[model samples]
Target chain A: MDWKRYLFIALIIIALFSVVIFVGKTQTPPLVIAMSMLATTLMVATPLTLGALSGVFCETSAVINIGIEGMMLAAAFFGWLAAIYMNTIFGYEPMPSLITGVVVAVLTGGIFGLLLAVLSITFKVDQIIGGTVVNMLAIGITGFLNRQLFFEKNSVFGGQVPHAPGTLPIIHLPVPKVVGGVCSLFTADGCPTFANALGKVFDQRPIAILAIVLVFVSHYVIFHTRWGLRTRAVGEHPRAADTVGINVTRVRYINVVIGGLLAGLGGAYFTLESVPSFEPLMTNGRGFIALAAMIFGNWTPIGSWAAALVFGAAQAMQINLQFFRDLIPPAWSFLQQSYIVGLTPYLLTMLILTGIVGKTVPPAADGQPYEK
Target chain B: MSENKRSFQDALSESPLVVPILAIFTSMVLGGIIIAWAGGNPVAAYIGLYQGAFGSLNALSETAVWATPYILAGLAVAFAFKGGLFNIGAEGQLALGAVAAAWVGYALPDLLGAELPRYLHLTLALGAGTLAGLIWGAIPGWLKAHTGGHEVINTIMMNYIALNMTSFLLNGVMKDPSPTNVIARTPLIAETARLGTLFAKYRVHWGFIMALVAAAIVWWLLERTTFGFEIRTVGANPDAAQYAGINVKRIITWTMAISGLLAGLAGAVEVTGLNYRHELGFSVGYGFDAIAIALLGKTHPLGVVLAALLFAAMRNGGTRMQFMTQIPVDIISVIQALILLFVAADAIIRYIYRLKASEDKLVLTRGWGG
Candidate 1:
């Protein structure tokens, strides 16, 4: 049944790719276009993949974290701010400053995660409302500080929006040699075009690659470790886990903080990796979309990654459509509208949620606060 | 007389409003601290806030104007709370309502090739918006009832879809055709379809009165009606309500529809009474703010109105506060979030104030499986 679902998703992705190729009207070969689209999909999916992983960790430990958006937003802002300060105030070089920014962003996310833990676990606030509070606080604090630090005339930076430190360097994988070696049996020229296209697909930034690595690492940690067993036990039945000498509160706290760290990394992807600058509400509901992906993936690490990929492909299609606006047929002129194209990911989320594919079952005690 | 006075003190201490008021006060204090930390005088900021919100007739009028939508949207969320459902889709429903109202406001008369009477045109436009919101809100309710889809995620998805759809329409077909205009907005509404102001010099319109009336009606519907009783029963314990032969599914759907209707009316009023055209970025975050208002109001109709007014005052005063103290208007959102936190988690307030637990506990919603 799971394989069938995966196959269905694969078919959809292929169909979406075919549409992009058909409407692209470029002289580039379909294979090269498809390769680039896959690359774009992976790049676009980086933040979502991290965010979904964040959800997976918290929810697996029975802490509902709707505050992932807030966490990401705060991380993005503080991370960017730290980078700027490091460059201007401390005279640190770009590479070290960016690394410091990433660290601060992760810590900021962890701090918020701890705050959420205190509110929901220690104070026993409703988890949903607690998450909402985090979100609102993030928005208010970020917006307020963004203005005072950069936009205001009496700001710390004297009203100048400092130049972005720089984006993370891409990890250049040696894909062309691998592709050329594989293609040597079929062609005399060793498939230079195929090598080049495949090479570009492998050229992604460190965080994007880290996101892919973390998916597997998280899957291993959640499914194959003693800690994973304890976490699941606490989530399903805290009293039972407690009777077995497992500290439920400790497990939940650790998992939630780990989730925050993941979300913080996702935030860093926005400022440090992708754009090198921060924008208000720039997470732009990706955290919510990541939550959807987590649920759609049935809260499994690999499943969520797969779901994130589909969403990423949808966004990639939208991005690709913008370049090929002139190529859209007269009858299908509506496809040229960026707003219409942007609806695909959200509409797809809704459709999946309607139980057409399959019902998603959350953990039994997913949102309940544990008591002694 | 001495015993009566003691009892009065006890009653005042026990009143539900105590926690909310204290929460607001604490949040304000914290906000002042934030302002001071940001190198602004907290006293001047608060003074400016008070003056901007209520210093003059014009200020009061602006507060009323802002409160109009907050009141309606707050009611939308509060009404859903009575039915054991969370209608986060109010934002989307409100947007669709505005779109529907704007379409009717600008296109209807032209389509009919005649001018409609002022009263009829206004009513039709408002009705169109309400119906659109009702439909938008009902879909998530129906999905939750029939298919076990969670409203939280669905509502968020619907928001994106509706927002994108709105952007598409505003950028394309619904765009103002005037040669000078390039913004993603509709043309001005017909004069007949417009809501009239209470005073020529003030922006306060009939919508403010309608919001007050709507609050009273919501109170009546919730307290003095059988359907309201059913909603409360379902909200308290769905299994018990089901055992009593209530159609839980229908109630949920209707609750969402009504909630959406109120949200839509908020948008409609904005279009017909104030903005006179539906534009992108207008009424942004009003729906989300309504959530905090609903929570702060303790999910009561009258409480919602009061909370809306408070929120409206803060929003209206924010500009003046910024002007006087150089504090960012965004501080209001932080304060509102704090208030919501204290209200939702009343244990903190109770602990701080050393108050005993009240009998009426707010059971917002159950976990995912529930």
Candidate 2:
């Protein structure tokens, strides 16, 4: 009900209208476009929300983690590796592989968080530098591992790497007759296609749905619980918390560990949910985007989740905007220049940070180490 | 004579070289153990790494080839440290510089409608890169001084703009339209504009010498001059520097510009001296790695040179270790990470060794919000 939130949503609706008009004028099917946008939005939003949730834990503890990208990349690789090992060694299904990926990712995140906390808090090192170091290490290690394991000239996975340009697995589900009628209209344009309809019900790919659920659970823990209160206190004011008998360092360490676990899980989304195998730098800069979402959300868990959705939708919009390729012109087509179009989220971040025009304030201790 | 000898011995113990050497030895031993644990023959891998990095003249030349840009970029980060700003956008700045250098190197002769002399064309190309970096560096400094925007965020954001724009330009406009070329890169510079190779038998060139000279100049600038004093004063306390009549904003801007200029030089050297053309992925992560180099070097210009050489050797040798022993290049990353971990959290190193706490702590960044 906040004016700012309303304004943001209104801006999104206006942008959507302009896109729809551009598509309609260009002779694209409206129903198809609408359904594709819906599907893409949900798909992109899943990982982003998970990342934002992880970022909330760190930001609330006053640690601005710029290493989320690295964490995600490393986690993605290890998750896939763990999955492959489990399938080969223990004869597990894809479900077990996904679980293994999440578990390994959490452990990886915890280790990295420990290193970051030790450097920034224990040694009183600069948090940004420490975060950057972790990021570099992640990139180097991931790049090296990717070259060694994945880049080989082999028929690995027997060539079934999901998301690498192929038919998506579709499962049928029950829907109301009216919704089915609407879906029928959509299917005419390749939208409410049999696959799309099937994707919507029993449509629960466990990882993506689990990630969404984790977001709400993480938000609840950060906002409502005693642990959450102490965590927020340590981030906001270590001295004040110390005066009150909250063990600030211990809280920071615990939260950092938990934050890492979330980041690790978020990383696994790249490998377990999107693709069957890992790619070098697959998480790319989403981790940094998540941090930006956390900040843009004003250090609150739910707000950050919403912000991640906004960023994720921006990504989805870039793809859905392709329906207007004919209207947008060949040279400046959002499809051809999707990389440029992809910059919308970062540009949005800059605008938000430049202050609502001047008052961009982070949490009081967002990047400060607990001195005591 | 005994007292004099003791004092001389004390001076030697306090020498800058001791710290870096110790750091290197410790890292190497730790790397060896990691390699063993990772199921590799540490002895053979070490030999291969050493051989590939410095076993022969060609290896020595390649080592210098990698070290040239590392030294310049390391200086970029180190110089910024003196001004108390972390120049994280060196990667972007370096990319912009390389593109500018390549454009000038290749297009200027065509623009002028004449074949320019090697010296003139090379200087112009190199200068274009430096100027490009100066502009990139100045923006964040100006923003920090006037608008209170954090440089960390801005610099990181600028990196995206620079890299993406560079990609766009290379893929679209600047992309070499020659039928044989398909990758996103510019046309090669004319032979006249390239910095001549030093040995004629190796890829090593004048850039190595230039880097060393730049290091010397940086050392003199930080340790000897009035301008350096102003930079240090502002870095230590901008408020105090303002009280002392130093124009803090101007100094921050100049410091950033100089830092950018050095980073630009790193890019320019790679193009004109090493790579001969500006490709999208040519520079890789040298700018980011420079931060680690600067930290390991203790932010001294000499320290930067030494650290850069060590980093250069590891990178140069890593390929051989992987090729010969089948160990992943990531193992080297583990070693580098451990080094950074130990250096950044010196307490861990200190606790392991039971050493007394050191007096000088490396404080590179201002508090996060600022």
Top-DockQ structure, candidate number: 1
Instruction: State which candidate has the highest lDDT.
Output: 1
Model 2 bad stretches (over 4 Å): A9-17, A29-35, A90-92, A150-207, A330-335, B1-19, B242-247
- Clash list (residue pairs), candidate 1: none
Clashes of 2: 1
lDDT of 1 by residue, B109-132 (tens): 999999999999999999999999
Model 2 preserves the real interface contacts to a fraction of 0.42
Worst 10 residues of 2 chain A by lDDT: A162-171
lDDT string for model 2 (B54-171, tens) is: 9889899999988988898899988888988988888888999999999998889999999998899999999999999888888877867766666766677777778778888899
**Residue A125 lDDT in model 2?**
70
Candidate 2 clashing pairs, residues 3+ apart or interchain: A62-A366
Query: In model 1 chain B, which range of ten residues has the least summed lDDT?
Result: B353-362
